[model samples]
Target chain A: MTLEIETGGVQLSTPILPASGTFGWGTELKNLVDYSALGAVVTKGISLHPRKGNPQPRLLEVPCGLINSIGLQNPGVDAFIQNYEKELSALSMPVIVNIFGESPQEYAEVATKLSNCHWVSGLEINLSCPNVHAGGLEFGSNITGVRDVIQAVRNSTNKPLWAKFSHSTHLFHLVEAALEAGSNAVVLLNTLPALAINIKSKQPVLGARRGGLSGPPLKYVALRDVFDVYSRFKCHIVGVGGIIKPEDAVEFILAGARAVEIGTGAMVHPELFIKCRNFMSEYLKNGSYESVENMVGLAHDDQHV
Target chain B: MRDSPTHFQLTITGNEKVGDRFFLLSFENPGVSFRPGQFAMVAISGEPYPLLRRPFAVSRTPEGTLQILYRVVGTGTRLMSYWKKGRKVNVIFPLGNGFEKIQNACILVGGGSGVASMIALARELHSRGTPYLLCVGTKKSGELDPHSSVFQNPPLNVKFATEDGSFGFHGTVLDLAEQHIHSFTCAAVCGPPAMMTAFLERFPDVNAMFSLENHMGCGTGVCLGCAIETRNGMMRVCVDGPVFPGKILLPEHLK
Candidate 1:
């Protein structure tokens, strides 16, 4: 019944973790979920300084999805370590800190500072976040920019580096670059760039005018990208986009993702973590699979490979 | 009943058009104990097109049913009206903080859809034998029948106000509450932002509990999309409160 995953030397109890931003700072979900039972707690994007995020109407509901332009609203690295380190450390699972920056040096600085903290299990470098004006999309969309930021953060911390990138034409190149720059794993894909307009008002629905689309609709797109990347690389891939049901998680694993991250799905149902775990465990047992790890990349047989 | 907000398949029992652009939707409650002002995130349709669940106040909890008063404002709500009875929709209930304990002789003032949140509070207060008054205001004379089962069965002392002067009082609920303000020591108000703002401006000294509304995503704290400007900076309306002390809300709105 073991559902362990060893990614970049970090042993996860389960293959399920809360995607960054959707899980908040960990404390917000303390009452709503049992954080200690999950694989890891990936916190919201944290920067060097506190962020006010975008103006009003930061979110909008589109067809089978959510479009949010939160602008990476966070309390900065120092405050996070100061205010939430105790609670995060108290959790039984790993604490993978998701950090973003305006530049490679800033990314390195935040990683360097966080590396000293004992509770943080790893670092998830946000290279493809689409909400912000600077840093996120700029570095995430470029190969060299992705390599530089990942390398900079890689040099700063000995912890596992998980370079999270979005679905782009150069996604595979970016993943290759991340691995070359010392990334232990790569997470794909962040939300797809999308915009919804209010025809009556002749204005955009979201405050930022454009936001990332996450939900059930993003599942197949994420699967295609994960499968394409996994076919060429033996490196660990963490698939995230629109993972709601346990079958979605299984699909990601078969598509070659070592683990799956739940974002909007978890928001809708806080108990989704437990449900996914239960369903996955039952599926593994009934199917007579030795372990969830064994199921990874099974679909990428001779034909796909 | 679960400690955390749990998802339940709610069967639509009734959908009544209570007023212009407003509908009172009743669904089979799965025995979740929720206080007044606490809301639920209801999926309008099973389709992915209306992806996010709409946040609605728990208007009433009678027997095995939960009622929500929703206004047809946007795409989600407009689609909700087309849903037929017995249709099942997903709902995560008992989300966010509800109103705190009200002192005796406190007046409850509601405006428009805000009155929906106060109905449960009034019912709870009535059961405790606490002396309270219900004052409701709407744009026209027939927004809500003060003589309906909701108001009349209990024979609750209800006051009415309308902008057109076709109702009991010829002004806003805040103006109607002025005469009764000296008789009560405290107040509980829920309504449109401007109405609540006006109430607080006039009764600065009175301790009032105001249930504020903001555009929400998750209706849980995770999304952090529903931010309310407070004296202590931006707070999530989903977590920090849909309910806040009048004193805290006044400074920002008053300024």
Candidate 2:
């Protein structure tokens, strides 16, 4: 059974990729993770300028999930290329740089610079980072915002573009807007916007006051979004949310995700990529499925009338 | 090139209550030695309630096993307190930067679980034949485990301070260190935020280094959850340091 599959014009050796923000530049965990098991490495979100991120208490662990408000803390685009370009270029697997900006112009400029780097496999447009005050969920809130950013970025580079979206009331329209604006794929669901409060302090727990929730609690919501988008559109769907176990990845695949991105789960279990890969391979062999491509959206076929 | 941290699972050999709130946990050594002040991210093998692993300063026992000195504070630690021997735990080890050795004799001040961060440094100083003093502070005598490996055989020059005056010196650890300020040129400290802040405020001239603790996600640099502002701008506690020079630490950071 071949695990090899293609998403957004980039061929992956496997269907599992590390979600953006969880893996740093794809090189931080080189010694700890098995790179061969991943389809590609999505970097932490990079902005046009360095961001200091949120203050203290940036992360909080809830039941089966984590609420994080990192505020897109990054070294900026130029610095990222300077510090990690050589190592990232040398990696045997593909590198998907996740880009963020405070405005559409800034997003385009950052994309223009990354387009110069030949080793960059694609650009995962971060339209749904809920932690920041600007250019995060704000840019993906409506059709116009999604179109303007994706169109601006698409005009800036010829690289594959995967528009990452957060769960919203009009999630499908946002997916349609991204595809209409030239996004090659849509990453269904970034994180669910959530808030946590400290009862004693009578204030929010996170420095940013609000954060995005990820982990097991997010799995069902993300799977439903993937199914909805897959059934409605002809675009590629990369499932991401709370994928902790191998079976979780399979569930996403059957729900119509061509690929799945491991976020909080990978931080907790670094070997999850390989574990998911192995499990998927066994699942295909046991079920007599020819490839991962065949497994996509299988659950849709079994639905009762 | 610095060696990358390895992820592995180890079986718990011992987990015993030390004091009212502290426990001494040990496991078979994976033959990976850590520098003084380095830490590890640890979690129970199969439990899933507490999603992320907790970071703890690592120490090696005289009996050739690795250990972590921890205090029962929250759900994670409360769960860890019940961990029995033979249970497997996942760990990512030899993480973050360790304390740098100073040339002159120095004073080491540790408060609460921060005392565990000083043990390896003290052991290293003892082996180098460098004269140093280890001053440990606790709320009271019940919070300290005198027989734990952290305070065992070596590192003979020792002192104790307790807020409740149940131990040697009364008042905070910094107040006790002030009595011996003239004896050492430098100091290494790790403890509660208030205690560390006091050390920085009181000893502006004395060369010092502080091992900071923060709520961390990934002990690796990726999470960026443990970032602290410094003279050098924002730096990660998991990578740039769990240890930082006292001079570079901004006053606003500790608070």
Whose DockQ is greatest here? 2
DockQ for candidate 2, please give it: 0.78
- In terms of lDDT, model 2 sits at 0.88
Runs of candidate 2 with Cα error greater than 4 angstroms are A129-137, A302-305, B1-3, B153-156
Q: Please, what's the RMSD in Å of model 2?
A: 2.1
Chain B alone, model 1: TM-score? 0.91
**Could you tell me the lDDT of residue A200 within candidate 2?**
100
Q: Each candidate's TM vs. the true structure?
A: 0.89, 0.96
The CAPRI classification for model 1 reads as medium
Count of backbone clashes for each model?
2, 0
Candidate 1 Cα deviation (angstroms), residue A283: 3.2
In terms of lDDT, the poorest run of 10 residues in model 2 chain A is A128-137
lDDT by residue for model 1 (A1-305), tens: 56888875678988889999898887677766766447888999889888878766788777688888887888889998999988889888899999998888889999999999999999999986432445345688888788889889988999999998888887778888999999999988888888999999899987779888899999999999989998999789998988877789989989998899999887876777888888888888987987778888888876345
Candidate 2 residue-wise lDDT, B201-252, digit = tens: 8999998999999988888988888888899999999989999999899877
lDDT of 1 by residue, B1-255 (tens): 324677788899988776677777888767787778888888765545676777888855435467887778888889887777998888887888888777678799998878877877887777677888889898888778666556643567788999899989999889899989888888888888788888877998998998877777788787778875577776788878888888777444422
- Local distance difference test scores for all models: 0.82, 0.88
**What's the i-RMS for candidate 2 in angstroms?**
1.1
